[model samples]
Target: MTNTAATEIDDTSSAFTPNLTIDVGGAPMLYRRTGRSSHTVPPLVLLQHFRGNLDYWDPLLLDTLAADRDVITVDLHGVGGSGGQTPDNVSDMTRNAIAFITALGLTEIDLLGFSLGGHIAQEIALVRPRLLRRLVLAGTAPQGAPDLHRWSEDVYRWATGDVTAPEDFISLFFSGSDDGRQRAWEYLARTHTRQQDRDPESSLACRDAQFQALMTWGIPESAKLQRLSAITQPTLVANGDNDTMMYTKNSQLLAENIGGAQLRIYPDAGHGFLDQYPVQFGQHVRQFLGC
Candidate 1:
């Protein structure tokens, strides 16, 4: 459906159950919109982690956030139900995301991005500072972040493994602690809640392209690293204390580099720390966005 105007259909009964689609630059982009619509505050647009689709979001977290503010979750180009080939780099991803937002007739939005999506969100804020009201980066790193290159091999190994297996998710997202493993299972359960109209699994090509973008982002030569100072949006940086995927120190770096940014680190968690502590995380996000 080619909808240039922002179309909002109310699913008041259950915000977590709706799966909607709109045309973004002539391609179908699948998304879910929930939460209380506000005239004063711009909607919170979420960008998912590597290989994650709109359905991959934790329903408890989405529902909790939606209780007060409008929450939007989308599938990036060529991932899940979105149509088009995946871009090979973060720059194009940022452009496409901007197009998606503009196509929805939104002039301002608050962005929350996780891992690879955080990288894209950073680019978006840098490229068009006027488009954002606030920014939240979770389980992510800045470009040219120290020791960023070390995680690539482990990421590749896990991504190439059986993605549908619970074990793989545990290995990739959580720490070795029993609590972490239990939270991983809960998070995985939430991901499977949308049994109908579910998005397709990310293709190998898309995964490879995302990996390439990630590697490029970690390179010191990438000019985007030097331009982070341009992102003046009120930002929140969050991650697990033991995040092996992106490393926790990067969150601190993000907070330090981005003027006035806040930082949060959850203990005994890994990359999916937000998912691990959905209630506390949701409260923090609500407080940040509300303030």
Candidate 2:
């Protein structure tokens, strides 16, 4: 295992630094570690959404979760400071994630994955169930979900049409209500707070690869919904009531299919529901993790 000594910062003021790197499968993987873990409580490993890196996390949410338990956020292969070509499928991405976790000497962890990250998390749990103690899937859906292709296509059109405009995010992540729009601006502001040593923005090629993987996962044959029954760990599935990127019903399906999974759908929110209700969501996660 290899890492830089974690630099401490005032928890009330700034987010923790994420300057550590380790070798995984002959490639460099970058991650940020915060908080301290007790003998009984395991560290929380966070996986980023599509085109996201360590810096993309909501500081309020990340700090809130880290206040009571250790948190580790990583940049997947080829997305940020991590080295290697980006995998075009969830299975390969899961393999690299397992490599990164094992390289860090973490035998057990609580996994939290958002959007695309959630898909990867499910794969990890299925492929290597023993490695995880708990699982959290937010703003995501199961494989081969009905109407997923249409929603993904619409989201893609909106996302690509005005990549430079901040307003585009409002439409993509939040609802049409006034409160949702207000929270969308606040969320945008929070993402820009971390200025130094931030990970690079994902390239167009990376985005294309991610969408390809997403479309493939949407196909009925590639879905592993039936295999989800194999997951026995305590799981928390959450999303907004009006999620357009991945329909809210998928969350219901996941909760129903995954035995004993807890589900929460925030009202008047969209794909970025966690960002909309960070404190409440954090509390829910902390309670579920028993921290």
Tell me the TM-score of model 2. Answer: 0.92
Give the per-residue lDDT digits (tens) of candidate 1, residues 184-254: 77677666655567778888788888878888888754454567788898899999998878889888888
Q: lDDT score, residue 232, model 2? A: 95
RMSD in Å for all candidates: 6.2, 5.3
Evaluated with lDDT, which candidate comes out highest?
Answer: 2
Error at 228, model 1, angstroms: 1.9
* lDDT, each prediction: 0.81, 0.82
Distance from true location, Cα of 126 in model 1, Å: 0.7
Question: Candidate 1: which stretches are off by over 4 Å?
Answer: 1-16, 150-153, 162-164, 221-225
Best by TM-score: 2
Worst 10 residues of 1 by lDDT: 1-10
